[model samples]
Target chain A: MQFVRAIVRPEKKDEVLENLSSGGFNAATVVDVVGRGKQKGIRMGDIYYDEIPKTLILVAIEDADTDKIVDIILRTAKTGTDGNFGDGKIFISPVEEAYTISKGTKGL
Target chain B: MKEIMAIVRMKRTGATKRALIEAGVAGFTAFKVTGRGKLLDHSEINVPCKEKLMGMAASDVIDRKESEEQVVTFLDDKRMFPRRMFTILAYDEDVPRIIEAIIKANRTERGAGDGKIFVTPVNNAVRVRTGESGDAAIW
Candidate 1:
């Protein structure tokens, strides 16, 4: 299994979930976070916003589902043609194990 | 580095955070989210209305028992399981210990909503200020 964390714009969160749900991959955990990327932060005239509000959607899927899930996210998270900075980033990692607390089942 | 993501009950965030801190984890992120799992619930108010509208509209007093039975399956998909999720990045060796701390702090009962922890291997991490990457970045 792979754990995918997508840090995306707050406004794009709902749309991302909708697409994921429609894709028959509805199991996901979301969290609201604040951070900046290579761009450092956003500046508005005389104001500087160091921490931008972004939604981090966390999902665990089988290795086979990686490409499909990433495709869904990129398609729904891009800012326009060619994309834009702060469109968000998706991080993939190796999941050691997963458990269902209710049933006490492990391994995926 | 490995990322330890723990989704626990909202009420347990404080205890969980403290546990991680005591476990020598320096940095992490926490957020509020609603999810759906194996827990059974009867919180959906729309299910009854939809059923009544679909069933005999002439019955002004909808059958409570029948409505609940018909909608449990449908409502399962729509249920929201409120959770507080925490993400912690630590050295590979610290992963197990960190997870143990979280489990110790979060395991209030062995039922649904108790929570879950996912450990993922992080390929790389970068600390923007110092331009440090990999293990240094995580520390």
Candidate 2:
């Protein structure tokens, strides 16, 4: 199994999640975080911030579902029409194992 | 000045997050992140290190900018299973509550294998559909 981490602009978080849930991949985890991407943070007016808040969406999927899941995330989080800074980013990683606590079983 | 992020340890994060929301947080993002700090198998160097794709997203009103900081909360589920990692992002106002709830959910004492929480600042946000501001766009 493969785990996908989508680091996207905070604004696009909802849209992404909505898409994921509707796309049949509703089982996952959500966390709020702060970090920067290639843009290395953002600048507004006279203010310069170092860290940018981002949403990390975590989901474990079958090896075959990896490509489609990533595609959906990108499509949902990508800039739609209005220009926006910090569009966000997504990363894929390996999950050593997964478990359902109530069941006390391991899924890898 | 620093990026805000969270590293939480728990199983079935979907449930933990639902609990946090009830505890009071605007909203959050999560990644399938993986990592080991204490019991991390330090024996292997290039042992194909595994890590979860962990991160979080937060936005604030233009006036409440100073409140942004790295929010860290730890959660623990003692079952002798593979440890899970998560990163949380939220405004400083809700850190205490989130931590409290996370601690409660993990069922940890002062400090166990639960996890840690951190926070940081966000640069800017704009609605992709209507060009709304970050706070307005996301929240």
**Can you give the TM-score per candidate against the true fold?**
0.64, 0.44
lDDT of each: 0.78, 0.54
Query: Alpha-carbon error at B136 in model 2, in Å?
Result: 48
Ten-residue stretch with the least lDDT total in model 1 chain B: B37-46
Clash pairs, model 1 backbone: B35-B81
TM-score of chain B of 2: 0.50
Candidate 1 C-alpha lDDT tens digits along A42-101? 989998888999998888888999999999999999988899999999999788877654
DockQ of each: 0.37, 0.03
Tens digits of lDDT, candidate 2, B10-61? 4647567777778866466665454322222232321222111012223433
Q: Any runs in candidate 2 off by more than 4 Å, and if so which?
A: A81-85, B1-139
- Lowest lDDT block of 10, candidate 2 chain A: A99-108
Candidate 1 segments whose C-alpha is farther than 4 A from its true place:
B1-3, B12-31, B38-74, B86-112, B122-139
